[model samples]
Target: MDSPVQIPFKSFIQLDSKSATAIYLQIVFEFIKAIQLGFLPEGTKLPGSRILCRLLGVNRNTLIKAFDDLESQGFIKISASKGTFILSSQKQVVKKEGIRSLPNDLPVAVDFDFKKSNILDNPVEGSDLSLQFNDGLPDARLVHTDVLARLYVSKLKRNRNNGVWEQLQTQAHLNFKAQFCNYLNLTRGLKIAPLNLLTTTNHEISLFLVLKLLINAGDKVVVASPGYYFSNMSILDSGAQIISVTIDEEGINVINLREICKAHQIKVLYLTSVNLYPTTISLSAKRRIEILELAREYRFIIIEDDYDFEFHFDNNTVLPLAAIDTYKNVVYIGSFAKSLPAGFSYGFVSAPPDFIAELEKHQRILASGVDVIKEQVLTEWIEEGEVHRLAKKNKKIYKERRDYFVELLHLKLEGSIKFQVPNQGLAVWIEWLPSFSLIKFQKKCLDNGLFLPKTTLYQNKNLIATRLGFGSLNEKEMENAVAILQKSIAEVLIEIR
Candidate 1:
C-alpha cells in the first residue's frame, strides 16, 4: 500500500487533567468522532503512536492503549509493519451538530406540552453526588474477605465435579434459602421455610418485583411521605397512584393511615419499617400490629423493607414486621449489602410461598436465576456462622462511629443544627436551623468535596433536615467530613445573615 496519510491532529481534541475520564478513553472517543465526521476517512493510516502522543501531549503507552481498544472494538485495524488504519466498516453519515431532521409535513419546531414522567423529572443528578451519605452502608474495607475467599475457593473446587450449567439447573440455591431461613429464625424470631424465601440482587429489585405482582393500573398504593423515593417511583412506574401517608417519630402515622384506608382501597403499602429511610426511625410496635390489622381489613399487601437490619446499634431491635405477621399480609425484604462488602450483597424476600413462586417466575424471565457460586459461598458463610460474626463485629464498630460522628457534629455545628441521635441505624436525623439555607449549605459542602445525597435534604413546611450516615465512614473520615460540614454551615449562615 502507498505511504500512510498524515493528518493535522491539533484542531480535533484537547484533554482535561481534572476530568474523571481516563486519557486513553478520551483519545479513543475523539478518534471515533473523527472517523465518524469523515475527518479521517476509511483506510486512512493514522500517525504512529509516538507521533500521535507527541502531537496530543499524551504518553505513548496511553496512545497505544487507545489504539488497542479501537482495534478490539472494530474502529481501526493494525498491521505488523504498517500503522493503525481507520476501518472502512465504520464509514457512515454523521448527524450535523446543533441541527434537527424533520419531515416535510411537520412544523420546523413542534410546540406541545411535554410533561416529564415521575422518574425522569428528578432534578438531582446522581453523578454529582460523590461522597454519598448512604442510608446505612457497611464499611466494606472492614469486611473479612480472606475467610470468604477460602470458602469461595473450596466451593469452586467442589462445584467442579458438576458443570456450572448443571449447578444452575439443580436445587443448589435451595441450600442458601434453607440456611437463610434458619438464620432468620435464630436472629429475628421467625419460623419460615425455604420455599418462603426468594433471593434477589438488591433491595430495589426485590421491591420492584413485589410491586409488579401486587399493583394494577388505577389501584391505590400507600407509601410514607418522604419515603424511599426509589420504591415510590417504582409504584408510579407500575401505573398505580400513590397515597402519601405522613410519618413521625412513631413511624408511619397509623391514625392517618387508617384515614387513608377509609377513603381509598389500598392495594399495596411500602415502608421501611425497621429503620425508615432518610429519618432512621423504626416503626413503633403499636403501629406495627395496627398496620397489619389494617392490611387485613383493607386487603392490601404490606411490603416491609427491612433494608439494613444487620447494623442495628441498639441491641434491642424490634422484630421485623414479617416476624410477627400472622395474617399473611406482609412481604419482608432485607439486604446483606450493609452486612458485607459490595458485589457480595445478597438481598432476599420472605413472603407466603405462593407469592414467592410468582415473584420467582417473574424473576426467571428477566434473569437466568441467581449466581450459584455466590449463593453457595454465602450459604457457607451463614452455615459456618461467619455472617453472624461479621454482623456482630460491624455493629460495635458502627455504633462507635455513630457516637463519634454525633460528638463531632455537635461540637462543630452546636446551635446551628438540632439532631436526635438515632437509636438503631447508622445515620442521624439533623434538622437545620431556620437561619441557614439547606441548598446553600449543600452547595458549600459540594465545593469542599463532600457530597450529601439529595434524599437526605428533606423539607417539610419550614423545617429542613438531613440524615447524616456514619456507618460508611471511619472515625477519621467522620471528623474531616464534620469539620468541612461545619465550615460550609458557617459560610452559608453568614450569607443568610
Candidate 2:
C-alpha cells in the first residue's frame, strides 16, 4: 500500500468557505473525485484526520465528518487498527496505470462533436487603429447617448414597482409598435398596424426570422451579384441555393430577373432597394413597378430591405416597393440602426398581419422577447418626435460629409479612380482604375495606419472597387485617410511596374 503522502491531496482538494456547500461535504466530493479519477489507488492509505485537517486548513470535526460520509458512501473503508483506504467502485477503475494528476482546470476544448459550418463565419473585422473605414455605418459620435440614458432612467424609475412578469404581461411594447407602424407609414408610405409589425434587436435577426418562415432547404432564392454578404450567409445557412442576378446603375436588372424566373422556381428575391448595398444606387421607380408586376405574375415574394430610407441626399429618392405592393408580395424590413445611435437601434419587419403573427412565434423561440425598458424608451422617442428630429439632423451632417469626401477623392485620386456622386445612402462606390492589386493596396494602407475592412473591398475579373463610407469620418479624418490611400496606391502601382 502506498503512503498518503505519495498522493498530492493538497494539489487537487480545495475548499471555498464562501461557497454555500459545507466544508465537510466539499472534502468528501474532492476525495471521491480523486479516487474515481485513479489518482488514489484502491489500496492507498489516507493521512490521519489530524494531519489532513492541518493540510486542508479545516477543523478536526469537519475532517471527521468528511471521513464518516465517505465511509458511509462506500468510497472509503476504515479499520480500527488500519488507516482509511480508498475503495474501488464499479463505475471507475482504481489502477493507476496510464493515469495522470487530477485535472485542476476546465477543459480547453469540447469532447463531443457538433456540426461545424464555414458558411456562417463572421466577415466583419475589428481593429484598434484610430483611422478606419466601414461599409456605410452611421457615425457613432453623432448619437445623443446622454439624452437616451436620461430617457431610459426615467422609464426605469417610473416602472420601479412593476415586476418583470407583470410588465411582460401588460405588453407595454404594444404602444411602441403602434408608434413605429405610424412612423413607417408616414415616411415610407407603408400602411401597417401594430399587428403587422414585429421588432427584433437588429436588421440581421429581422431578416433571419423572415427567411426562416419562408425558405426551405434546396429552394432557389435570387439575390444581386456583389450584394450584401451577411444576408447571403443567412440565406445559405437556411439551406437555400442562391442565384445571382446583375445590378446596373438603375438597380437590379428586372429583365434578367424575368429570365431567371422563367428558368427557375424562385422562392424569395432579397435586395436593398432604397440604396443598393456597396453601390449607393436607388432602384428606379420604373423598375420597381416592373419588379412588383413580376412578383405578382410569378408568385414570388420580394424582400425589400430599405435600410437607409431616411438618409437620401438626392430629391429623386424612390419610395420603397412595399408602398406599391398591391399584390401583398413584398416583405419590408427596416432598421433604426442606420439612423439612430448604436445601442438604441432596433429592426422590424412590416408585412401582412398573418405573416407577422407567424414571425412573432419564431421570434419568441429565437430571441424570447424584446427589452422592455428599451422598447418603452424608443416608443416615447418616436411618439415625442425625437426620432424624426435626430434623423433630420443626421441627414444634414452626413450630406455635407459626403460632399466633402467626394471633393477630396476627386482632388487626390483624379486619374486613378472613377466614381459617381451617390444620390442616396452614406457610401460612395469607387472603381479603381489601371487595376493594380487591391489586396496589396489594402496591406499598404494598413501599414500606414489606415484600416480598410475586407467587407468593403469588392474584386472580380472585370472590376476592382471598394465602398468607402464617408458618414463616419469628419473632414480632417477623411483628408488623412485619403492621403494614406493615395500614398498606398502609388506604392502598390510602383511595385507592379
Candidate 3:
C-alpha cells in the first residue's frame, strides 16, 4: 500500500458556484491573499495537474489555461521535476492575478506558519566570519534618506490636496533615469534612451517583471547553474521551467545554451551579461554575440539583468546585450540599490520602447507606482551630478576593496576556496570546497556580527558561496572581516580535516 500524500490546503480556495466572480479568478485571488499572509511561501509546490483537477472538480484545460494566465503575470512556477509552486512571496508587492496550474492530486494541508522570514533575527550560531569573502551593500547612512523623507511628505501633501499626481506631473521623474543613462553611455558605453526605461522598486522586481513578460507556462527558461538563486526563485515561481546551463571562467556556456534550446523550446534566456552572481564572470564578447544571434534565430527573449553593471574595476565597460540588440530581443535592467546607497530604493529597466510602455504597465500594476518621493529625490540627486560623482568615487573605492579583500583572502583560505575575475560588477563570487554549504557557511558568518549576502540569495542551495562586497567595508574593516573569516574557516576546515 502507498503512503498517504501531504499537500498544503489551509490557503486553498473555496469556490461558491452562485458567486459572480469566475472560479479560476476566485482561486487566483485566494492564493494571492495566502501569499500576502504567508500561508503560501515563495516556490510553494502545488499538487500535480490531474490531482488538482480532480480535487477542484475542474477540467484539466481550465487549470492549464488558468496557469498560463498566471504565469504571464509572474505568479507561479511549474516544472516537471518540481511540479507547481507559488512565485510571489506573499508580500502583496506585485500583482498576482487569477492564474495557477493544477497538479493532479491532493495531499494533507501544509502547515504554513513554518515559512516566513528570509533572515534569522538571531541566526544559528558558529557562522564563519574569519575568511573575509562577502558582498558590497552601500551603507544606508550615506544615502539622502532625509530628502526621501521630504519627498514622501510632499507627495502625501500633494496627493491629499490634489488627488493622484497626473502622469504629466511625473514626467520629470524620467530625468532620474535619463541622467543615469547618459552616465552609462559616456562612462560604460551602453547607450540607452529614456523611452526604453521602466523603474522598479528594486533589482528583483525588474527580474520578476522580465520573466513574466517573456516566459509562458511550461516554457523552458535557461539560467547559469549556481547563478543567482533569487533569479531561480523568480523564474520557477513564474510558472515556467528552468534549464540550468554551465558557466566557466569566460561566462555562460553558449554552445550548451544552443544544445538546451535544441532539445527544448526555450522561451527565455537570463544572464548577468556583466558580472554574474556567484562566479562574477562576464560572458565573453564572442559568446555575447552568439547568444544574441541564437535569441534572434530561436525567437527567445534574452533578459540581461546587467545588475551592478555600473561597478566595474576596468576603464573599459562591457556593453549590455540590449545595446547591441539590433533585433530588439534584449531586455536590459539596472539597479540603483547596488550603486547608490541601498534602502533608498530605485532601479530602471530598459528594452524596446514599446515593451518599456508595456512593462511600465506591469510596474504600475505591481506597486501603483514607485514611492513618489524616491523617484523625485532620486531625480534631484541624479540631475545635480551627485549620483555620478558618488558612483565614480565609490567605483574606485570598491575596486580597491575587491583587490585588498582578495589579497587577504588568498592569505587565509589559500587552496580551500576559488573565485572568478570579471571585468565588471559588484560582488566577487567565491565557490567553497564541496565540503561547505553556504546555508551552513552563512550561519557561521552571521554569528560574528559580520553579515554577508549568502550565495543562495542569487542562485540555488548547491552553490556554496557568498558575495564579498568591497563597497560595504573600508580598509580597516575589510582587514578585520577577512581575518575573522580566516579564523572561522581555519577552525571549520580543521574539524573536517
- lDDT per residue as tens, model 1, 169-218: 35667777888889888887778998888888877788878878888899
Score each candidate by Cα lDDT.
Answer: 0.74, 0.80, 0.64
**Which parts of model 2 are misplaced by more than 4 Å?**
1-108, 163-171
**Candidate whose lDDT is highest:** 2
Q: Return the top candidate by TM-score.
A: 2
Clashes of each: 0, 0, 45
lDDT agreement of model 1 with the native: 0.74
TM-scores for all predictions: 0.74, 0.77, 0.67
Show where candidate 3 strays beyond 4 Å: 1-134, 144-168, 174-184, 187-191, 341-343, 369-374, 420-422, 433-466
Residue lDDT tens for model 2, 1-497: 34676566777685655332356656766776666556676677888878877788999987886787677556688887988777644133211212123344545457899985535645666666789888888788888888989999998888888667565634777777878889889888888888889888888889999999999999999988778878887998999888888889899999999999999999999989888986888888899899999998999999989887778876665789998888999999988746666667888899999999999988889877567888888888888988888877887899999999999999999999999998788889999997654645776787787888757877655678899988889999999999999999999889878
Give the deviation of candidate 1 from the true structure as CA RMSD: 15.7
- Candidate 1: residue 252 lDDT (0-100): 93
RMSD of each: 15.7, 19.3, 13.0
lDDT of 3 by residue, 402-461 (tens): 787778778877787787654565556666664643333443454454554423233233
List where candidate 1 sits over 4 angstroms from the true fold.
1-132, 161-169
Instruction: Please say which candidate is ahead in lDDT: 1 or 3.
Output: 1
